[model samples]
Target: MREVAFIKQNKEKWLNFEKAIFNQRFKNPDELATLYIHIVNDLSYAQTYYPKSKVIAYLNQLAARAFQKIYKTRRQETNRFLYFFRTEIPMVVYQYRRYFAYAFILFFAFVAIGAVSAAYDDTFVRLILGDHYVNMTLENIENGDPVAVYKSGSNWGSFVGITINNIYVGIRAFVYGIFGGLGTGWILLHNGIMLGAFQYMFQAEGVLWESVRGIWIHGAMEIFAIVVTGAAGLILGAGILFPATYSRSVSFKMAFKDGVKILISTFPFFVCAGFLEGFVTRYSGAMPNSLSVAIILVTLGIITFYYIFYPYIVNKKMTLHTYDSTL
Candidate 1:
């Protein structure tokens, strides 16, 4: 958007924020923090698009003061770890919600591309998944155990190995964002396409149900965490690409901090998914259909709520709680 039009759009909001800062109208530290968030966003825009405008200086000074007030008036929050997970991450995620949309939309589109390409060409799946893996899976399908590969390794060995691998994948996805988010998109594309082709291969073998019962036992949270990590990478890239009112270095530092926090939040989910994959997925064929389905639903629900819905809930409570203090 053009600088003048952008300023015209956020001008009134900035004025109100200025008034709030000067008059001490914001009742709580959270409110000041919230206002600081707004100022920083505007400051980022002005820096990126209106670097030469006087408004960049104006927004920067206001943002700096608001930021100081947030730290100065803040009560030391008890349960720092709990607060980090319960309050901080959710607020950050809410602030960058649009990136989630981008990651999901792009990943799913890539998945569809893989599925379409595989459907038309028998060799596409073998090319993506490797000939040996495809042949093993096909042999397993014929043997009536299409997911036998997951059953290989001792449970503890599998758990530790898989957890580390999943964490590595998440970190790779986040770290790759340093290259302007294209690297992160590539990560998503690689995985999403593989997933699409993998599933389609099972369906073609007439054993999708058998594969899903085992795969989705862990895939739900595992896949969702990857998507969230991809969003964090995009957030990092945005810092480099946008740089609002800050210098490139400063913007990159701020973005890295926020992106790391987001990436760290998914570590627990990765461990959980790893546990399920190592212990439960291998036994999915033996499990009652309802049990397998329940595990998949519960895992999916937990990650979906935490990363997606929970952010809105936390933001709402913060807004209402702080707004009520003024009365």
Candidate 2:
């Protein structure tokens, strides 16, 4: 059917339904729900059948406005933050946990491999770090300032540059998912190896513990964001590899949606990481051991809650309330 014919047939019904809903003419809760559902069904069909049609666009706008009204009037906030933690945050955390875990395992495993390689071959650090960076660090260490590289720039300059660079890396990692995971894995591997080599360099200088306490204040979130980006890549790649119950195109679409959500959420984390690297990392030399310990602990706490604890709680609740349609 033509868009006009469809619109003419349904327009009166839709307008009457809207008036009934807006005018508060519902006889009961069941009637209200039924009306809302009809609106939802019509909206879905209109989008599917006449996606670019003016009627569909108008319907979409109408639905959105109506939804806002419904949510506004029915607002019942029993602590907004608590509600977010109890509901949206947990669900989001659960959805991305797989990607997060993949990122952590892949990066850490690479780090471990780097450590073993460094232990076996003294030249491996030189190979990974290049003679220039390795020699520079050694020279800095000899001067009794092992982490002076961070202080090379103005704080604001470093912060803006670093944040922009990290965000670019994250976006690239996400975009690389188009190659069906290979590209994403390669990007992650490159980063993971670099991180491993960097950390091993510090260890070789006999300052691995100090480096961890000092670097991880920001590195925790920074590295975690990289991992999340890797996970986004994996999610995109996985769709290409195995569409499962969906057609390949449909699966790819869904994967992209999920991956985008995960990637966007990491933006704030990257900014925080940049701020720490610029401000806190530059002060690592003057930082007290106590403050370093506290920061490390806090970083660990956040990682633990987001990666382990939050996901567990979400899955547990999901299992318990399997009957709930929202899941």
Local accuracy by lDDT, each model? 0.86, 0.72
What C-alpha lDDT, on a 0 to 100 scale, does residue 324 get in candidate 1?
Answer: 57
lDDT of 2 by residue, 167-235 (tens): 999988988988988787777777777788788888888878767776788888888778878888888
- Residue ranges of candidate 2 with Cα displaced over 4 Å: 1-89, 314-327
Residue pairs with colliding backbones in model 2 are none
lDDT of 1 at 1: 89
lDDT of 1 at 9: 92
**Best-fitting candidate, scored by lDDT:** 1
TM-score of each: 0.83, 0.70
Instruction: Choose the strongest candidate by TM-score.
Output: 1
lDDT of 1 at 123: 95
